[model samples]
Target: MTVFAMLGSTQAMYEWAEKNQTVFYTQILSRLMPAPQRDDPDVQVNQVNISHLTNLEAATRIAFALRLGMQAKQELEERREDLL
Candidate 1:
């Protein structure tokens, strides 16, 4: 049950991420840029590069986190059933 809940939450998070990828990347770039006007040509160029790199990093991190969580949940279920 707990495992299912975790899986559901993970799925939901992934879905949300997928649905808002553009927004998420935009926000990330916005944060990376200096304050005030982020529309400067130089800032825009840097933001574009940073956004691409950060997007890849974010994807990798999410995948790694999900894999770890799934493994931990599976282990917990196995232990629970063994004690049952």
Candidate 2:
């Protein structure tokens, strides 16, 4: 996420995430791997805003973004009672 580096603190990070839900959603969309045989094999999805990172770094960035996204949702969702 472009917002990853922008996070100044734990509180600020979640606040920024809450404000920019669409940005994270867009990041998730962009990071989705294309068809295996897509013509543009070299097409980089998550590296546009984030530059000068190695391949491993780019992958790590994506992973962190995904983790934060899921964490945000898990924090917001209401728990349900068990049927059993």
Candidate 3:
């Protein structure tokens, strides 16, 4: 929902989602929802293979990855300023 809003239009949202739908579930799911522990059986349930993803889900994953990159960039800029 939030990512769709950032995309600026229904068409853009549709295009981005369509482009990303083929990505494997593990690519995003593991980052979004990690098991409580290593080797946990619940991880299997989260690992279900799927051919397509909901538009909202795909948007959310892209939004999350973008946010992470933005944060890293901001931190680097701040560190550089401190050294100046």
Against the true structure, what is every candidate's RMSD?
21.0, 23.5, 20.5
For candidate 3, write residues 1-84 as lDDT tens digits.
Answer: 887677777787556657786553446545668668557665645353334878888788779879999999999999999999
Q: State model 3's lDDT.
A: 0.73
Q: What's the CA error at residue 5 for candidate 2, in Å?
A: 53
lDDT value, residue 42 of candidate 2: 81
Instruction: For residues 27-60, write the lDDT of model 2, one tens digit per residue.
Output: 7445765746656778867536657888898899
lDDT values for all models: 0.75, 0.71, 0.73
Cα displacement (angstroms), candidate 2, residue 72, comes to 0.4
Off by over 4 Å in 1: 1-52
Off by over 4 Å in 3: 1-50
Report the lDDT of model 1 for residue 17. Answer: 65
Residue clash pairs of candidate 3: none
Better of 2 and 3 by lDDT: 3
Q: In candidate 1, what are the lDDT values of residues 1-84, reduced to their tens digit?
A: 687587777687567768898886687557877878546565534222435567778788678879999999999999999999
